[model samples]
Target chain A: MLYEKKEAWSVLLRLYHWAFALSIVCLVVTGLYVHEPWTSTQLEAVRTFPMAYMRYLHFLAGFVFTAALMVRLYLLIFGNRQEKFWNAAPITPSNIVNFFKTILFYLYIGKKDHRLGHNALAFTIYVVVFLLAVCQIITGFYLLYPESVFWQGWGLKLFGTQQQARFLHHIFMWCFMLFAMIHVYLVVWNENVAPEGMISSIFSGDKFVEKS
Target chain B: MSRNLHLSDLNPTLDRRSFLKACTMAAAALGLSSEMVPQIVEAAASPQRPPVVWLHFQECTGCTEALLRASHPDIGRLILDIISLDYHETVMAAAGRQAETCLHDTITKYDGKFVCVVEGAIPTKDGGIYCKIGGRTALSILKEVAPKAAAIIAIGTCATYGGIQAAAPNPTGAVGVNSIIHDKPIVNISGCPPNPINFLGTVLHFLTFKRLPETDSLGRPLFAYGRKIHDHCERRAHFDEGRFVEKFGDEGHKKGYCLYKVGCKGPETYANCPAVRFNDVGVWPVSVGHGCVGCTEPNFWDTMTPFYERLPSVAIPGDRGVVSSAESAGKTILGVAAAAIGVHAAVGIGRRLGKGSSCCAKPAASTQASDDKSKE
Candidate 1:
């Protein structure tokens, strides 16, 4: 009955994917370095080059992270949807059930179960990462408002002086570290349990399933 | 440059009878007791300007060099005019027996009346033989001079904490004048060849008030040593913004970013060099694209090191990529995470052993059992 069913990552989604990942990694590393004496301190352009350049790099990357967020939101709202259990998992109760089951499985509870759609564990990671990213964006904007007013201007006042904003930026960075460790563990665990859970979806936009 | 100190300058040197006669005349002139007039006139009309005996201990004589650079219209002349510079080893014209005689006479005559300005550190090891002036140990010389002085001013880092000589493995046990003279009230003006103005300020304050100015816990004058250099650094904006130069000539270096990343001890050091500046010049160390060496801090020689490296402290707020210390943020989040992990693990293990245990064990269990029937 199906006329045509093609599997592929749309350009906008891929743009969102890489940008989000890069931004998260950047935020985590910089945040950690600032807080603790991690590896002493790596020399940067600020060490050799003029100070303005390092600031530019940090500030400019902030906007890129914001743009990536915007695109992810767009994909959630406007991207084409296929009539498949996997892509449409968000709408199914099975998705919610699988999410918790995955959590229990990770904690080493019961027999492994097959899951389709956004699995239970995946949902939780998704939510936590999304929130932390939002925190980073808010804090980043607060620091950037002296230059960027669109979002950061009000954020600055809400956070108090630039020092308070700075203190928050350092504190909030740990979220990304926690998120990353958990993300890597769960993604690989998912890959092991359901070989094509994330890999197939991001690459081809479709996951293989046994027919009835 | 003049060497000789006159006995006539002090009318008190007049013979006992003449002094008593002068006292009677002065008392009548001033309406005071006859015997008290000479002493009163000496105290009121021309009190002896505090004699400043500049002593060079273990140092480069930088404090002496720096003092010569002072220019406040008439401050240098005022110093020369007011203080009887009986002896300054570096600049005084007297030498050999003449200089020795000068020091002896000043101590013998002025004794408790003159002020002593000791520059550089005093070595205490090896019977204090590491440094000597005129074949006498610096220690013995200092011990001899310190007791008689009314007040003592120890100028420059060399005298504050032995400068770099006391950095590590201090063979000589080089120490400040205070470390050697525990009884005298020592006023320290600490700096690596400290700003001339700080020294002048202390000296003027002493002259005007006839008493030492307020000092901090370390016996440093409060006016200059009260504030941190970082608090007033011109590049403070760069530090607050998390803008820093990583290397010797990177792009940020060209833009003159903060040197905090490059071992700026500004945070830990307390001094006003950044505010008052040096040499009347418009720039300081950090302003010149270098980090503060914290030259003013106590034992900055040993405590602050890797001169071009960041201090092992601080995650400044207001910086774009700043992250706070984990002690507050990391500890709280980590605690939650650890608790969450523990609870989750316990729930999973309990579920494996029992009927229900977890965030949603019972619901997941019923559903999984239902699914098993469907698969069959």
Candidate 2:
């Protein structure tokens, strides 16, 4: 087999992916603490940094996550073809057929369909997850500031009640959690099954794909 | 012809001391200062009773019935005497054309001077044919009555967020008074049957101040619907302690643990129910060992359904079935993922054993290096 090194990801794209991933990690940890503090420590200091600091870090990470998403979306429109969201998506009839074929390959019932970027199914899932991320941002902020003028005036119109918004924020967190689990597993599996160096792609922006 | 007439002398049902006490209590319930009691007493003691037009539409007449059965034994008489109730379908002595005649006459005589109290929801479906008063649809009746009133008070969840009538697949297109009459400064007293004190306080506040009290975005008086029920719940300690009632007859349930696991919407619902208690008996839904249905909230009927579930159920009509609850669905997904990962790992091990050493060694080394890099 002959292998070629392709520039599958730009440095900026890789940076954005890691930044978004790290921020989501921060958010999930802090958000779960905010939801239900499971700490056994009973520090009685006046300047203790317990729940308050967790919340502050969560808010800061939230801003970073939102910024990363915004920048990624902007780059998807204007960046190179490899970085464009549409390159990975390819929602045509052939791509739809390829999506099923890729699924079959995952189940070990079909031949390998190696690519430098995300598969059609993965792209579809990514799109759905991105939409969920958008939902999280909207609902998260609304839940945080239900009493604000902006929330009372416009947020209520966009999302119904604070309860409903909080529900969505929580549901989306689960969605991201679920996605992260599957995504990490699949990436590791792909790397192990086929020496694609999938995990290191985020840091190196390069992958060696074999073509017959 | 004497100018020195006290409220007790005129009413006879309540003595001077009792009347002042009631006034003070009402003022306090309104979240008003002690000084406002004198103003409330003065307003209630005035010679002229403010004419109140009580309109009923698509409703069960619960709000009026609740008021009648208030904690204060003489609350009914006090409310009636304080306000010259021109017309109320459920309580008025007159009926049929005679009652309709009184409503019309009152609307004409005190067009912009009287208070308009609307109970129940207004149906807008089919030209508002769902409810009628004197051959007039609810929409038309409200249109005619609301604009002429000095102030409108939409009492109960029905007249606030269209209540259960406006729930999902709402055939009648029910809506609150605010949706219909946008011109008037309306106050919404939202609950299944809102606390009688809240209604009394709102009325007394209006009577005392000659203006509506400050309201939230939903047009509900801040004094009653300011804090979440969860904040003041008696079982809040249980919630903070992470002790939850998992099921209906479990030890936790019997021991009066937090009902959050059993779908208590109190955390999401904003009302002073826990503080004030229903019927003033120190017993609310939570006190009675049942979760709050969140009836006071907007779209509660649809949004807060599956009353015993922790999270709202996905509404997918017909045979395809529903997505039980958010938490349950999430747990199921997580369980499936865990199982799938376990199976996949087993499969991977089996394949590796069959393939022997050559296929596994290099990939494992590379994957390990990559994992380390990712961690960094």
Candidate 3:
């Protein structure tokens, strides 16, 4: 019957969110174009730098994406209680139980589970997505500086060749795209049904919760 | 100094002037400057030619053919003047027992003082029975010769990686020289048939410096394999401009546009072919209108196949029969994910609407009961 407004995300956290999201969007778009250029200029080869420009954009966005991930990783360790990794993704027995409950809630078999931050299932997926981001960064750097002795010894040994690294990078790009789609849909769904202001919280850093 | 035998004396056709020019060209190709020419010339005429024993196995003799076509110094000058090629099956006048004798004599006479140049992949399956010479398996001969040599030179893709023979389902268990000889310093000059200048440069560097040139992790000389082919491509301007050849004989093809769209492997392949060219001619595969096949990379046959396509197919794990490009696989997975989400969302909305209609009166009754209790 009554609700109270509270800060769910810090200003810094919100900034990191949009930066990560926008950078990923730029990376994917430019990365796909670099992978397979779809446009060609009619101007002289010396007059245009279409492919070069695409590659430059992709690399620039990659650095931005990497920086955003670094910030999030720092926050995961040292941020507020709700933003701390263990608090959000704890694997305790009760957390495991609630993880399944969240699944059931998604399936419309149970009432919605209320939380101040990410639900158990969502947090687990975020952890996996973060791991993929790390992999993307490693492979991206390997592709960028293939002649580096460090990468030649370690990255080549891990992925076997530049082609394999490119493949993994491409695969991870799709994974991020998939995650973004599902994440947007779920946030919209929760905003409409759960009265948490889930969508607006990302922008305003506040959400309405039960008074208790 | 006693009148030492000069390089010109051994190869009369290569006069002193041409000999000096060849040396300079070689130094340039090896990423050395004019200052190294005198040292190279001295090494070339030193008369203490380092004996070389060339072995062939599971090969097409293309590397030797490429060597013969080197015109700067010529193969005759190379084998007779620069380095003493004691035993080469393709060029040696000896055969059968005589060839075997030459091989044995060189190994023993120049023991720990000669270079061993392996020209092909070694067959290790079934006791290396797939390839043999004089009834001796290539594996056994290599095991015997590699240990005695000062350094091993793996002089082709076959000897560096496994080449075409080591592609998927490698029936003969083909392996490179490095796979067998780990104790000795091995230099890999990798290519389908490596440029002869690279080989000559490596040998001359050894003769001049009394040691092998610096090599990449793959054992290829850094002078040749340090930068990607794409980095120094003649058609790089086209690549940057996004002007590409779409097909084999299109207008773009005739105009010499970038071959990136037609599956050029230069972007991923490391070599100096664009600069050095091949057969002493100013033309390589790309310069002549074909895309690079990435011949110098390890496992090129498997990793750089479908020569006219840009990217390798993504191998599906646990299912050898299914292979798909990365784009196709990504599109399929994204499609499935979209459909699943659509179904989930539709069912969720339908269930919520059904519950709202059926339970519309229950919440009103409970609110009224709570209000009455609060009044009491």
Q: Which segments of candidate 1 are over 4 A away from where they belong?
A: A1-212, B1-48, B70-78, B318-376
The sequence of per-residue lDDT tens digits that candidate 3 reaches over residues B1-376 is 1122354346456567666766777799898989889999999878888899999998899898888745444533655577888999998899989899999999999999999999999999999999999999999999999999999999999999989999999999999999999999999999999998898888889989989989999999999898888878999766654467889999889989888778899888999999988877678999999999999999999988889997544211211111112223434544543454355345434544754644564453343323322322
Give each model a TM-score: 0.52, 0.53, 0.54
Give per-residue CA lDDT, model 1, range B30-71, as digits (tens).
233555554533542245667778888889887777666443
The runs of at least 3 residues in candidate 2 whose Cα sits more than 4 Å from the true structure, single-residue gaps closed, are A1-212, B1-12, B312-376
All candidates in order of DockQ, best leading: 3, 1, 2
Worst 10 residues of 3 chain B by lDDT: B315-324
lDDT of each: 0.64, 0.77, 0.79
What candidate 3 gets wrong by more than 4 Å, as runs, is A1-51, A54-212, B1-12, B71-76, B312-376
Cα lDDT of model 2 by residue, B2-34, tens digit = 123343246446557657776787887777889
Docking band of candidate 3: incorrect
Pairs in clash, predicted candidate 2:
none
Instruction: Indicate whether candidate 1 or candidate 3 has the larger TM-score.
Output: 3
Model 1 in CAPRI terms: which quality? incorrect
Worst 10 residues of 1 chain B by lDDT: B318-327
Q: Residue A95 in candidate 1 has what lDDT?
A: 68
Clash count per candidate: 30, 0, 0
